[model samples]
Target chain A: MNWDYLLSLFMGGLTRGSIYALIALGYTMVYGIITLINFAHGEIYMIGAFTALIAIGVLTLAGWNGTAILLIAAVAAVVYAAAYGWTLERIAYRPLRHAPRLSALISAIGMSLFLQNYVRMAQTANFLPFPNLIPEFAFLKPVAHIVRSSELVIYAVTALVMLLLTLLVRFTRMGKAMRATAQDRDMAMLSGVDVDRVISLTFVIGSAIAATGGVLIASHIGQINFYIGFLAGIKAFVAAVLGGIGSLPGAVLGGLVLGWTESFFTGYVSSDYEDVFAFLFLVGILIFRPSGLLGRKQMEKV
Target chain B: MKAEFKKSLLAALWFMFLTFPITVVRVNTIERTVAWRWERLIWIGAATFILSFIWRRLLHRKQTGRREVSAGEVRPPSRWKQMAADPRLKGLALSAAALCFLVIPLLFSWNKTILVTNALIYVVIALGLNIVVGLAGQLVLGYVAFFAVGAYSYALLNYHFAVGFWAALPMGAALAAAFGLLLGFPVLRLRGDYLAIVTLGFGEIIRIVLENWNALSFGPSGIDNIPPPGFFGLALTLRQTHIAIYYLMVALTLLTILVVHRLQHSRIGRSWEALREDETAAQAMGIDTTGAKLSAFALGACWAGMAGVVFAAKQKFINPGNFTIWESILVLCIVVLGGMGSIAGVVLAALVLVILPEALRVFADYRWLLFGALLVLMMVFRPGGLVNARRRAYAFEPSAPEKSERP
Candidate 1:
């Protein structure tokens, strides 16, 4: 094996997986609470990228540079995405909450369609170049041999975010409320938890995290497009399912595994068949172990 | 009632205000310039008029506080159905309806005939989908893949082996049915949203294969110059051919309705209904859930295949692009908006959904946007559908309740 080539591929996969993990976190969190799938979550990510791209463009034009531009862009994307997520819940979901499961799903599908077309109409169809924030890794030639500085930055940021999330969910009162709500909505309500507020906050948090992922990915890939969300959403959904939907750490693990599989499969096999591999993996897991690798077996209510 | 009216009106106005930016401001991507679509004002006007009319007509009826019940036992007929279902005039109305169906196409201009033909084609597909989505309660987002399979089977057979349309029709449908069984076997164990996403993935895979396999599917540019079906070995001119095909589509639609309606009352159909209402309980009740699900998938695919064969014959061409995810969404909308399991509802939905956007060519750009909004709004307001299916009580007439109860 060419160690250098494998090392680079692994690095690339890790970067990609970090973003997938971010996106999958949103899906898994929402599914944990309501089990709605949130089909429009991908569009939230896309909107994040767009919002970040515009922020960066404006900031750079106004003479902002380097880390400052990235900071502002990241904040802008997360805020915009959180707002979008909250509105989505309020409009597309809240009314249909008591309706049939199929109806809410159909409504979600409609929301997905509307958002896709809305972005397609609002933005150019073609991919727009994203501003590159990372400096040339000329200074890191000694320590970083195979991986670039940008890749390291991605890893560090992802690790920091994950740590922050773990701390929040483990220690914070609001996080406990979210957890209580996710466990049982009616019980949580009975216990005086603001279930509605918890759900809304979950959406806001998930969208913000996904937006951070989206901005980072846009910067890494060097371009953004309207339709990227659909496929990426599907793949990340597969990741969430792979790890055990509703399990946060499981989502992260699944994302990494999915990313590795894609990288290795593309290196050895046909890149065209990579998506097929992800879905096939999903089917294989679901057939043999429906609860996923980490998910607890849930009993169906009579 | 007055407060309720005011609340609903205020809600509508709020909704109107929220959507105003989207309605009036449209970005022209090609020019990279933003412009106002002032034409949306006309739509706003029309919408307010319709809303006011509905408020008056429907709310006024509600205010009367009338039961209009036949007996206290039977399920109350919706106001529209009650008006249409007079016992003395039932036979006369049935005959009139049949007469209208028979003569309507003949009265139609050529363009309208084409539109009707398209609607009939969707009607058949939607009815097929109704079996799976409505009766079985399985959301198959990839339903169009079966349609594509049938179309391609007919086209490939004709292109490769000189098979005629008549011979290929049943063969195409059988092939699609087999494919359905193939898909059903693996997916039978899954349910609900999991089943939905997996099927969606399968559908995408199928499309990608169809698009990528150049040697087999002609690589998405599509098969062209497919021969239309012959009427009893008669070779007619183009105009005559279109008319003949329209009639053929009509015949096929009637045949589908007959089959689906018959099956809806059959033992298997009851099994499907049982399963749909509650799969675990139905299985506990000795219904073969697997068999019911597989049958629903196969039968639904069978009709879609028939529609596909006709589609290939009518258009005289076929492509992977023609069988897109959007087509699946379109057919699902028809079944849903028409009321899930109602035949008449499906027909009406097919007509309105298929013909309305075409008629409103000025708002063609907003077609899908409106459709998306419609799906959300319908789910919120009328999840049961415009003409939701009502369970028939006559099926239990043998052991009817001794006393009628009023709600």
Candidate 2:
């Protein structure tokens, strides 16, 4: 029955799903708060990877240790990405808040294009080889064939992050404000919540999460390019939609579902049409279940 | 003013800090080398400092402008618009524009003629997109897929059989319209952002399939040596053929303008506009939102298909790369920047967008970067577009004061 092969594919899917979950978290959170797709969110992820690579290059040249370099690089990426996210919202979205939905969407698309070219021009157009920072663990030698050490690390990190996020969103006062703002911006504003601050904070947190995903995935893939964000962003958006956009847990579930779907399809069928399968699956879900798996359906107000 | 200066300085510093990692530091990981271009940081600081002032002023104006608009102040129309609206000036402008279009190819060089022809093609495509996005309010990001359908229909038909361009043109439009209807049927129920993503996915799906499906699309290498449109068995040289194609595009563009302008004034067009404004209201008014939306998609696709066939004939080659998401976005930009639902604006924007890059060959590298920034800026400052679409204003005659109400 080839249980081992299936198990490996499962683990691979799990790893991939966690990465998508990381990026999807950003998209879902932003969409939840603003109801805007935040098309530039993917570009934030790419920026995170680029920032991390720059940090790594500098730190390594200064004779820093591996662990310290990784830690500093990750922090740098997150902070820079958060800043980018904040500025992006202020510049591209803030003014369009009262405009038509189409205007904001077009603005977002424009921001995405601008950022892609910005990175491409700032960095080289060619693909950069990302250094593998995750070290091999000796404890998992026997079951190494089933899952690599990086996969285990990914699972643990994703779980820890998810737990922390859940705690923050559920237990904190700021989280309460964020939730209120997401529920209804005008109401929140009337209730004395700083809606603008909440929205900015939402962008910061989402971009930070996306940056973490960007760094981890770039390290895993061992390469970085300016165009990576577009496809990954779309796929993650799909994941966010699949689970029920605007729901955190839904994003994770959607990511896992999308991951498994792609992994299994690639494993059994020809890998050539793997992307087609994901898109077709999305089309199917959107047609049959427009609100997604966990999304609440709201009646249109006249 | 001093406070504004302080704010600008702070913004400049914040931007410098934000851009430090990417702009100031260049890292070559494989070689373990890092280059610090500190000058770039200075440039960023200077640029942001100056831009912040302009941005703040514009934002102030926009906020005040909104209030004035909501207060029902009748702002005077711009001179160009007023001239366009006046019958006497409008006729003069139209004749002048028509004369320029007719005489341009005859006087211009071959390359310039070709460039103008390309711009005309975009004018048609952008007008088509204007119908779907501007009129119907469906954000179709994969509009180029239909264009590809038309292009490939002509390419494959000519390659496989002895089908000529004249026969393939209508076939291409029909095929694309069918494809549009196919995509529109199920997706008509979805809302804005979801619809956008689905269309985008549809676009990528088409591109990927074309790239992988070697049996049909000839893979990524694409089909080459496509013969240009036949001229009734008249053998013309290469230059003459290009000139003829230019005239063909001119005629096609005028025809598209006529069709689009008529459609915009038609009953179905009003329905589309109503649906765009409010779906529930439109449906309650018995506008048949489904038919209006589907027709918008199909009609838009129909024009794109025609343009696609023309584009293929012009290039004398067909490739999947020609129909990327970027091309669709370019047309979208033309529609948006020109002012959605404005025919003259779309034509003007298409000409500017297509010809500007060709005119400024030195700034080719920064073309997309500038386009991206322009989009954001346009949305922020002028969402109404370069030339705002004028609503059909009917003269309202006020009734004389009644003697009974005078007391």
Q: Please report how far candidate 2 places residue B251 from its true position, in Å.
A: 0.6
Chain B alone, candidate 1, TM-score of: 0.82
Using Cα atoms with residue i matched to residue i, what is each candidate's TM-score against the true structure?
Answer: 0.88, 0.98
For candidate 2, give the lDDT: 0.91
Best by lDDT: 2
* CAPRI class of candidate 2: high
Off by over 4 Å in 2: B399-407
Return the clash pairs for model 2, or none. none
Residue A183 error, candidate 2, Å: 1.8
lDDT of 2 by residue, B1-407 (tens): 99999999999999999999998899776677889999999999999999999999999999998899999998888887677789998889888998999998778899999999999999989999999998888999999998899899999999999689999999989999999999999898887888888998898889989999999999999999889998989999999899999889999999999999999989988998998888989999988988998999999999999998988888988888888999988888898899988898999999999999999997678888888998899999998789888878897977777734654
RMSD of 2: 1.7
RMSDs, each prediction? Answer: 5.0, 1.7
TM-score between model 1 and native: 0.88
Interface RMSD of each: 3.7, 1.0
Candidate 2 lDDT at A174 equals 94
